[model samples]
Target: MRSECPVRAVASGSGGRRSYLVTGYEEARLALGDARLSKDTAAFFAGVDSKRRLHPAVAHTMLAGDPPRHTRLRKLVTGAFTSGAVAGLRPFITRLTDELLDRWPADGPVDLVADLAVPLPVMVICELLGVPETDRPQVQRWSAELFAAGEPGRTDAASYAVAEYMTGLIASKRLRPGDSLLDRLIAARDGEDHLDEDELVSLAVLLLVAGHETTTHFLGNAALALLRHPAAMERLRSAPDSLPQALDELLRFDAPVSTSTFRFTTEAITLGGTEIPAGVPVLVALGAANRDPRRFPAPDRLDLDRDATGHLSFGHGIHRCVGAPLAKAEAHIALRAILTRFPRIRLAVPDERLVWRHTRLVRGLDSLPVLT
Candidate 1:
């Protein structure tokens, strides 16, 4: 409620986990960049042995990390994310999009979630990471387990499965290497930085999961938003050149992430006129921040021509998603190709009947049925 106060302390109903929710646009952006914030989230798992706690296999700390460590971990992989590198993926992404669409049901309702939105991103990421075709299904299952609303034990099991898989994958890469992203990361790991085996696995896991999951949500949510707004959809279908800006608007209108990753303050800090004590967990609501009327007039309306550049879809600061370029390229190719192939696409079912995958971290449709 930025209208009343930007920052409000809230408690979860499930775990009763206390967190500060920052809902204002400017406050959310600034809070994300606050130096007093620390990503070392082990403090959340209060009673467990810190060594045995959840240690993600990407970016060293998943979404948490401050400083030179975050700098070093991110730098090792930044070389391959240049504009040219991501642009180079255009042809591959286009080819994959066409191939996937070719297999879509030609005569009846099409479930975009299963047929296109889900598999396409996973396939692209799999190929990029050199994950074998046979193993893709298992990887997808593990990824779903981590994101889906489920019991804690089930999610933990899924996390362990993914970590163990990545650990083995990294070990194999050390003996026999290729030019894939995983191979490059392995080389960096073994290089002068002395990146440990665990960190190597973490990075791979992060890449494989984050690389496609958010993009999957972006694809699904963007499509649904476009379908709901026929004027914008028709405009993009006719003038595909403007699809990039349209995608940006779509992301802002309905951000893929509901909230930013947890950030705990290292010291007392004032945010949005609210003083947060040291070590309080913070949840920056990206979805709410994007819709702030102060920043975006008529925040509920989708305007393809609106200047939505500053939207937090890719986040801001060093913690911003490293795969933003790749994600944008993939979404662009996916949307453009869809428009060209299915110019008459529309929702197959009533909008009210659609169900959402309402997880704590991800916001996406369970299935998006469309007709062409």
Candidate 2:
């Protein structure tokens, strides 16, 4: 099973279309940020399968766009998560965190993913988007279905349902505008360069999915990392100032996202001395990239003080995660509070018994059992 190649040739889907599974950090970075490499595969290739079918709603995000449009769309709501905006949410986030912790049974066991990790992001994102409290469950259900990898049919239906729902949500925001990110985006303008209807809807899709899904995985992964490193946990609990650095290390140690958004080759080019022809797909493995020997010494070890900020957990280049600051704040607050309040927190079950989501795209546990 072992191979001796920097890049390996791989078959993609039913057709014989080729792809290179990139591993080296610098190589992957070069490939990912390269201008010749295109994110839109369908534009260059013939009959290539659109990965969007798996989660069309998520696909509608700025992730799917390139250059000018992507630039404009990301800029529209840039002010929404500004330091001031994030600071404003801190009070609400703290109250929400305390309420969740207060509700924790204080006895035997609980699934963190189910009880805290999932709902926190959902509620926060819903609040930011001004989604009604009553409508959150529906949104959560649609998101779950949309992220279901094996159930393509269900995912397709969920994607359509959410898109329809969001379209309505955007319309409502337009009519009864609030101070939410959605409303601000609708009203936002940069010298008359306003987002069109489709752009606005796409931005909404990005926010809704990213709001919950990525953070949920991050918190779960972070909890798992802490559970794996008891020494690190003890150090963190003893020195709470280390929480931010530790969180960054956790992100680099085992990034929640295994791969970057798929990059399709627009024209033939050489990468890492390998000639990759045009009309081919490429996936940059962030998990592998983070652990690359050249990038970090003792790559697998969780060093709380290691400079892990530049890690590709959020992504790289122009497509870097737009919600990174928000995600970081949420994770930091959640982890800090969990550690500070539940000083004796530990896993409810053995580590080996944990079940990881099989889908390679997202790295997360199906359930995180914990004891307080």
Candidate 3:
């Protein structure tokens, strides 16, 4: 689309809503940080359709709010994901990665998505949130349904299930709290400036889901990328220190989030010489922007040595993913562990036979079969 028009309006859909898609790298970057484009879905939809309402647990999150609300909610959880905090969890992540890998069979094909990628992040996030091991299986199921595309009924059910689960969990933590992040958040509620029940539940659900989903897909995508590019895999295996840089290149090559969440235009804005009307929705194509030739030389080629500093994988601006540091830490540890454990691991099936999940919000494999 960049070749034609970076910012182009899509024909009105069934709802007769006009939306804009930003495909160019520069346009997407600018649009992502632009305050003129608001993330307050409630306010945007209030006048558009009064009867339509989202679940409180889904609506009142930092992801769906703008400015003041976003600022406050983000402040409460920001400290937990800071570099120092993530650094402290490195030992735990490394140990967890080893433990998960150890359970894999000594000789056979294994689904990396199910065996490693999914569980690693799920367990890490669950531990951080203080979810008991007994409840993790159910939590994982609900989270999976929440992200399933084209299934409104299942999505709504999952949302309600998660809200109920978190609400109960929060109540439990109130009586006997621990040092986990959830406990600290509960403590925050007792303070002078505090989170309400809805906000607290919403934030918890957001963390539980977002904390793991991105990294889950990222690991799968990164593994597939390495398998396809033998030289890149060899480079990382030969020099373990290069894994970090290679990860960035891998993310840019195949972003986990194909498109960003909705951002509505607060006022008429021009992007890439195209003026979009106010109140219209805008979708930034993160995957496309990352591969824009104008921004990166030989954009499609996986160059681990190249500096992929501006990739929009985790997004840009204030709403950029807060879990990025932890995700990277987990991915780095997990990827390194996988490589070290199975030096000759390769795809069990042909590349074309692999199936991707049918979700628009997340880009991931349904299963990554590989021989160890």
Candidate 4:
């Protein structure tokens, strides 16, 4: 796409609705941070008729709103995921990783996605949110279904299910308050500013879903990347201290999110010499941008020493992922633990046999069978 034109318009949907796809690194960076691109889906589709309507709690999330609302909502939960706050959870994450790994069988292949990558982040996020351990399995199921592409009915059902679950959970938190982040968010106040019933439910759902999904895929992707690159894996195994620095390159090499969430232009904007008109939807290909040769030398080759700082894996600008610190902390602990525990871990199946999840937003494996 970049070879032809970095930004180009394409037939995105029925009824002649044209959308833009930004694939170049510089163009994607600019499009992500540009205020001209609005995230307000409600306003965009105000009068459009549709067969299904999203629940208010699902539709009004910070991810779907532009600034002012986005700023207010993000501020309430930002403190819990800051670098210092995440650092405080290192001991907990390390302990949890050890516990999960300890359960692996002594002599057989295990699915890393199910055994480690999926549950590790789910448990961590659930603990942080104070979700009852008993309810986590259902929550995980709903979260997974919400991302099942090409299954609109299932996705819609999952969205409603999770939103209702969060609503009930919030109500429960009010009766028995705890020190978890959810408790703090429920009691949070900025003068007269407070989250209403809908906002509260929406925020909780967002945190629970987004908090773990990206990291889950990231671990799978990182593990696969390491398995493919023996030298990089060996270096990390030899010098555990360098894992943190190498994580960026890992993220760059195979991003967890293939493309960013939808952002439509409020007005016409030019990107990479292409003019995108007002109200046109733009999809920034994060995976494609990360591999743009102009930005990263030998972009396809995984080089741990390469400076991968500007990668758009977590996104850019005001809407950059707030959970990045926590995600990084979890990855560092989980990867280090896996490498240390299973020195001889290798993929059980051939490279061509591994199956990827069928989803547009998330890039992850269906299962990663490995011999440990």
Candidate 5:
């Protein structure tokens, strides 16, 4: 796979265990979509010393759920992010993008990550969760540390802080409810669908982190691809309809989550001729599968014109990202606006100097310095 993508796996695993990394497209789909694999992270979750700091519950989102529970959690929020629902948010999203652009520097380079990518989604998510705007920065910080490596105690502290904050918010919502998603959720009943406080807090945190972090990475990545490939960016700038197609390719070529939230093996399964023992954890390489040559010719090269919709940036089947439509809308607005406003946008720093978060599950640069 390395010959095809950035990371390669030999048909081997440690301890001469005859382990093999499934790199092909068919194998990936079979592994992820099949019922034999589990989404529970309990195997590793228990073994890992919380030496790195993560709120136990915060680590488990819809990403870590399966079956009836997964259905419940996802159903409560999916309606808010469907095509029609996300379309409803367009006016607000456009206004937000415009406001950010208006404040952007007119001449020199600016870090798009800070100026646009970070706040746009963060604000949208805050609104969705009914989180106070003033609390967003703090929420964003906590979300970052929960997943970020390199710091130990800090990640734990941040996790606890977020948990505490959510706990307070949930308590408040229980009393004085408002006309927001959170309020509706607190009042939700699907044959008595009310969530326990713990469940409610868990969903709130999931949406907060997933809603912003993943979409922000998409914006940053799409921008990076355009900046690197001038012609693709220009084509998008010239043809408005091309934006959607280009976004598809960008998603395929540079998936945000390098791997899906971890999945465990339920029963012994043979993948790539290796038997993954039941209860073992396996990471889905979405990025690697996105570039599988057997599935996409010239897979590594970004082609805005290609049919790129089948990419697994969103996991397949029932586990597909619930917020996909909302995310796509944001990406279109963000990228189109960036291209139109700054047709001459280009990387301000040398490509080699750009740094990526080595510990992140999602793939994105720390700063996207661009001349606007």
Candidate 6:
């Protein structure tokens, strides 16, 4: 599709909106960073004043926003994820990885999603936000709802449940402070800058939701890629330092995020010689872009040694994931440890039996059962 038609009109999204999808590498790369594209959906949603229509708390996330608002929200929370701050988590993350691996079932089909991938990031983000271990299951359940495509009511209920929980959590943090990221956010001061009540809750939920969900998919996809490609796996095992670059190739080969989040043009934009009119929704196929043969040779095959530097797994432009470093650190350490510990790890079931997430928003395994 990318080679034949880089940009084409599609009638696939919900709410009866005209949509456009871009699949070429250069097209998606440029569109993601395009100023003409806006993330605010007020102009598209039906029957209400976009300005006065109070979007859901989770909707306040900066990933779905444009500048100024994005700038301010990003600034308020940027310090918590600085390279130094994220790197500071290495020891704790390493310890956690070892602990989880040690607990894996000795002689059975272990669901790696439940055993490692899911829990690893969930625990990390929870700890970062000072969420209790006891509350992990509940938060995990609610967070899973974000991927419940075609089930608006379910996702809504899930969002509300998290919002209610965070309200209490925030109130408690206000009373009894701790040295967690939540505490930092609660008291995060940038001269005269700070988060209001809504912003605080929104940011917390965003971090918790995005913090684990994307990373979980990434870990799953990357693990599956390496497992299917033993040469790549063995190479990483012999030289663990190569795991970093190998991760990039794995990401490009199978991006966790199949499509970039909702983007709409403010004015008619021409891309790939296709005329996209104003107010049309645009979905950039990140996974497709990563595999564009015009850009990366042998794009479908997994080449751990490939220089996959400019992959869109973390996205492009200012809207790029802020927790990218932390996610990479988690994936890097987790994958290395998994491969190192279970040198003979392989899927319990045939590849054809595996199921993928039904939603197009994310590309990941529904469950990855493995024999460690």
Best prediction by lDDT: 4
> Per-candidate TM vs. native?
0.95, 0.94, 0.97, 0.98, 0.92, 0.95
Candidate lDDT (C-alpha), each: 0.84, 0.81, 0.90, 0.91, 0.79, 0.87
Cα error, candidate 3, residue 63 (Å): 0.3
Cα lDDT for residue 60, model 6?
Answer: 62
Candidate 5 least-lDDT 10 residues:
4-13
User: How well is each residue in 1-372 modelled by candidate 4, as lDDT tens digits?
Assistant: 787898998887688888899999999999999999999988988898876655777766889999899999899999999999998899989998999899898775899999999999998999999999999989999988878878888888888999999888888988988999988888873235677878888899989999999999999999999999988898999999999999999999999999998799898888899998888899999999999999998999999999998999999999999999999999999999988888888999999999999877889999999999
What digit string (tens of lDDT, one per residue) describes model 3 on residues 1-372?
877998999864586677898899999999999999999887886756543234679765779989888999899999999999999989989998998898888776899999999998999999999999999989998988888787777887888898899999999999998999999999898886588888889999999989998899999999999999988888899899989888889899999999998799999988899989888999999999999999988998999998997899999999999999899999899999988889999999999999999876779999999998
Weakest lDDT window of 10 consecutive positions for candidate 3: 46-55
Error (Å) of candidate 2 at residue 79 is 2.0
Model 1 per-residue lDDT tens digits across residues 1-372 = 779988998985456767799999999999878778888765554564542324355324556666777787888777677788887778888998999899877764889888888888888888888898899988998888778575666676788888889888877877889889999988877788777777778778888888889999999999999889888888888899998877778889889889888788889999988998887788899999999999999999998889998999888888988888888888899988888888889999999999999787778999999997
- Extract clashing residue pairs from model 4: none
Ranking by lDDT: 4, 3, 6, 1, 2, 5
- Name the better of 3 and 4 by lDDT: 4
Each candidate's clash count = 3, 0, 0, 0, 3, 0
Candidate 1 residue pairs in clash (backbone atoms < 3 Å): 57-202, 57-203, 58-202
lDDT of candidate 2?
0.81
What RMSD does each model have against the real structure?
Answer: 2.0, 2.3, 1.4, 1.2, 2.9, 2.3
Candidate 4 residues lying further than 4 Å off, grouped into runs, are: 189-191
Residues 213-312, candidate 5: write the lDDT tens digits.
8898899998998888888888888897779777878998999888777676777777765567776666677888888887899998989778988888
Between candidates 2 and 3, the lDDT winner: 3
Find the 10 residues in a row with the least total lDDT in model 6. Answer: 46-55
Better by lDDT, candidate 4 or 1: 4
